[model samples]
Target: MSEAVAPRAAIIRRLSITRFRGIGNLIWRPGSGVNLILGGGDVGKTTVLDAIGLILSPVNPSTLSDTDYFGRDIESGFEIEAVIALPVDSAISAQVRPAWPWAWDGKDAVVPALDGDSGEPVYRLKVRGTEDLELIYEVLQPDGSTGNLPVMLRRSIGLVRLSGDDRNDRDLRLVQGSALDRLLSDKGLRSRLASELAEAEVKDALGDAAKKALADLDNTFSERSLPVGLDLSITGGQGASIASLVGLTADRNGIPLPLASWGAGTRRLAALAIAEQRQGDRPVTIVDEVERGLEPYRQHALVEKLQDSGAQVFVTTHSPDAIAAASKASLWYVDYTGQIGPLDTNKVARHRANDPNAFLARVTIVAEGLTEVGFASILLRRALGAPLSQFGVHISNGGGHEYTLELLEALNSGGLSFGGFADDENGKHPTRWKALEDVLGPLLFRWPKGCLEENVFGATPEGKLEALMADTLGDRTGMRRQTLALRLGLDAKTFPELATAAGDRLRPTMLDAALGTVPAGREEDKGAYKSHGGTWFKSLSGGRELAGKVFTLGLWPSLKPQLLPFCNSVRSAVGLPSIEDLPQ
Candidate 1:
């Protein structure tokens, strides 16, 4: 028989939060891969993750305690609101509103106003001193209206609140128990027996032995079908049984193993395995300080594992290694203002200059935001007719100045060339311009003659060439002003403008120019002209014409013999196919 396939876990498709403590309402679309939430402590990173859990699984009134894990009085009232992605069969779209039960004068009395529906049947719990909590549980009807809330939420709020901390609790065991465990328990058997008894119209047709046999059969079937084993072991003196699922297990040294007992990396690996096993079918897995308590090597392993798990993993870390391990697209930097924005990979590359590994190669363009990177790449590819990846470009979504600097340093150290692009920000200070020049040298190109930031796609193609030539040739003697000007079709006066216009376009053109290939032509004024009875040499005197032609008649013949080999070398360094087959 074919092996049974495990059911695919439900992914978190959407997370919406409204007015949960410090955070004003916000929605996040976490990627399927590890979503690293980089931020300082107390920036609502954990709160946002907790809100997700609370929305799906609210704390039960019976489970509430005066002194909770954080040691704060378990206030009788708290509000949590969120919309989670539910399984396809889930009655609700996974919307949840959980709150502490309200009591007035030590008597249980339902709040009358809470009984009224805003649109659908709204469940409300009014805790006297706290904000009124309302849960709108509705299902999409065939006629486009909302149906009733799920019976599970009405019966027990704990069904929605899958508390991470409560997973180890015994009374809370009902919530954390695996499907197999639920199938083995007396409760599950009793429920099954009750259903059968009701169906057969018999009070106790199924005896205890029959129930036990059914439970055993279910457990055996479940165990046979699972990809991994689950074992429970009681730790001596703690009165707590630790469950080992998947391939994880405590070392032979025993519980409370010494820090030195296992390799430094083992803890991170163990934690990662535990997280993956516990994640199950849940959508979001929030890990606090993923980089904390992990050594550098272990951190990389953890990042790889998280990425491989294909779950939405949110991690906060101060470690550069953790940031480096995260893909440029996956990284987010939390600012001092508590706003989380993506990191510019280029900026990150520049920030950690001392560490070579901090910089990433493979042409991943890092931009400050998703829109900028998306639009810019579209514009560049449309204008250039070449894949941006061909040029080793990556766009990083950076939060601010600090992130920008970090990216630049990281990239610079990694021996990658990157151009920084940012918004004009109401046309105030040129932030991107300053960032590029400070790290890469001076601003070689600016848009509209240093007015707006340089239009990266529109900049002349020769700038990258010029920068390369300047760096490689090391002197103006071989790359003479007049000769170079002729190659680029510019007089000395227009040379600066042309050079500034080159931008990234310069690199490829420089390679070609160095190999004795003529540069493309553009139109410019030949001489003074008169229009409609105007004087000669008028401002618009010059008619449309070729600005300048790259003089190759004698140039190629003179330079090819000496420059061909060098051109081939430059091409190889940049990972481009050789130009040896092309005509000199």
Candidate 2:
């Protein structure tokens, strides 16, 4: 006989919060797969999880602690409202029928937003604090017009939270209601009685017999079913005749290893494994710092695993790998203003640098190349008196001028503000330049002439080349490491000699010889970046340090006028005072 298949119950479609912890007012509309919450610390990421836990938890919780109130103000009661769209025959519907908006669409799904629909038929759970400082939940009508719902209707919503710290508490023990016990029950029911067991005959086993039955069931189901290892059985007390559910006792090499003895990563993964079975008809799991205590590969795997668990997963993180692993549509930014919302991924969005650090930043500096990244970042640090992380600024090298627009598109769609510095050489392509100009407007910064090596560093024959090089010169270690300098045919002392021998072989820019791509005698056309300059720059590992040299070399005083627009743009993006605001 086939095992009975349990149907997925309706999930929470929306969550509204007011004056809860750090949040003043916010609404979260989560999608399937994952909703990755992002922001700096204390921006209400954890508050959101706590608020959801307050309203939809399976087990009724204790009274609210002082810290649970927003601003710890016991006087100003906080509220959280969630809309759970119920199906026609929803298990919770019988208890919640009075509160439902009682409206349905052509598909029989509630369409509160449909034309002329008076009220949306959603099961709304509202939690608030009373004057006596008591916390009570009021299940209001779908239109939020009435309250005092039946007590049983509160169980209609299923929410499981993996607290950032104490996930070990979720491990196996059918006695204390382990998440494992919840999953092993019929139709994923959380029960403490014989009727809830998946196999009725195994319920009466004492000790060794219980283990035997569990072992037999293991053959039919692997740990992959939950995707976290939780092998369990019921054990009788040492001196007693009664059986008790064994919680979180597993072994490796015949040695018993308890859940408490495991590391944070292991315990967290196990909690998710147990919680995976918590969904009977409906399931929603909220995890704080999902990437905490996880390795790099595990971080990437975590996103994929949560999305496939057949439940709505909400998570918060500061890890860039997690940001990159999450789709643009799934990310929500919680800023200082108490706004939590989705990014617009429908447009041609781009993130060329592919750096997770930059992806999570509220603002980005889309540099034209690697050298520019190092160059602009060093300047930003010097000006800001701290790293870019402090200001939520990320410096990204878009690889080249061609992908600049793509990066901007992505940054925009991802709800990030971006400004860029590109070469004057890019004016050659009007189509691309116009696109950049139209989107960026006055935000774009252009080099005075030619590329960074010439304008920013100092162009040869026109710029104070000798002084610039002498001032910006850095220690040369990697240049000799592994014949790197020789491989690039670079020796500053031999440049003039190579120039004499190169004759017409060098491009008009003489950038080929500057970059050391071709030998002095070779007859070919190439720019500095195309040949030796690219490798040589990578070896320097001091683009910012070199960029710094420009300031002391007296280049900034002259170049300041040309770069004022870019500097102001950077200041605006980071919410800092503009260069114009500073006294001369």
Candidate 3:
């Protein structure tokens, strides 16, 4: 038969804060997984977590007297605002308010102040003239009317008062007395079985019986029952016969023998077992400096056990081993500001994955955008003849300049190369370039002229070499060039319209006019195109003919052998160099 299952518990979803002590009224959304609140000793980290617990649980009168809650004495009260996620079955939203000590009457409970318009009851408690404690009940109905209090709400309030306590020790005792005792006590086990049997609605009788039977088996294994007259000596000089049941034997003199008479580690394990047995089903468990009082190996075991128990665990530590036992996402470094933010998991993971001696070996690459990286990778590969990915290139979209800067700073701190292109759409601002260069240092690189010119054929020399193929293959293979030309006002048609007309002919040009590359043309054609100041081809070479500059200095001399064939073919068509060995 299948075993009985326990109901899943709901977790606290959101924490809202307003005018709390030390904190300047802020709402923080904690992550779902294990949240590590990290900050310097007095940065209100513990205060935040305590406030969350307070909101979820009933208000303790001791909190009213707590110095931190109220600025000074308990009389000079302060306000606290918070909201908590409750189980769907529990029809109550968490709320709290201060109550004067002298506002409660003996027999009747005084209703706290209510919002007249909304009719929502605001929580407040007061001691009456006779010093009698009054339990005020206010009912806010969905129809915007103040109505009679629900019986369930009043009962729940009673439960809250009975269940809540100021001291952690008292709270632990209450938990142990209630659910823990019922789950772990032998008498309580029988009571559970009897209750299950009495409830006819519990259909799976055999399965229920099996659960009871298993509980009995667990009880046997859990406790040590000593046989009469066989005294056993526990480790640390505690004498008990139960130790013999677990393989501890007495010496020849009939004196009880110590279990640690076996091993010190075993004795420590026994103490841990006793502690776990004492702490039963508590909703939340706080383990401060859990790694204390244990060897490194034992500390690891304790962490594993605690994590496997499915309890909400909070641990504080300065040990690297403790941090290692926890996942990278769970490790948080406490900052001076008291704001618990995420740690750099990427760096931590890299360090763990690659045990590098020097911190510089942990560097990472961060880029501005995918396109900038796309072009940069092509350019660098063409210039260096090596794969850019070998350097660990990463791209971050320029959503905002601040985010790019933050990422760069983080990577640079880890000794990584960080650089990428930023758009010059804002007129090539010096401040923006300087800001990035300041963060990235020597790793930063950008185009000399601030922007790539309209026509761009390819990222590399090879791609640019292929771009010349457009002359033979027709303009069909150069869409990027044509599109860029149209955008920069060098082409007559718009990109979309041009693409419709020329198809794949819109290839990018390798030659950057901003880099002093001029279009080749006839001397007469160049004269017509020459600048008369601030005109098209004229301003390119100080009003000189475009053809003269192209022939004299624009084309690189190293390309002479390769360009001869293309120059001859193009010259024959346009009445310049013929399709023959002209230069070569």
Best by TM-score: 2
Please give the CA lDDT of all the candidate structures. Answer: 0.39, 0.59, 0.36
After superposition on all C-alphas, the RMSD of every candidate to the true structure, in Å, is 21.3, 13.0, 23.5
Please state the error at residue 430 of candidate 3 in Å: 9.7
Cα lDDT of model 3 by residue, 461-523, tens digit: 332433232323123335434424533446544445443444344343223222233345434
- Clashing residue pair totals per candidate (backbone < 3 A): 55, 7, 26
TM-scores vs. true structure, each candidate: 0.37, 0.65, 0.34
**What is the C-alpha lDDT profile of model 1 across 174-215, one tens digit per residue?**
222322232233444434543444455232455778656656
lDDT of 2: 0.59
Which lDDT tens digits does candidate 2 get at residues 183-297? 5544323334333443444444448877677666776567447433325343334332111244476797899887756777777777777776554444577878877778878
Output the worst ten-in-a-row residue range by lDDT, candidate 3.
Answer: 158-167
Indicate the TM-score of model 1: 0.37
Compared to the true structure, candidate 2 yields what TM-score? 0.65
Collision count of model 3: 26
Ranked by lDDT, the better of candidates 1 and 3 is: 1
Ranking by TM-score: 2, 1, 3
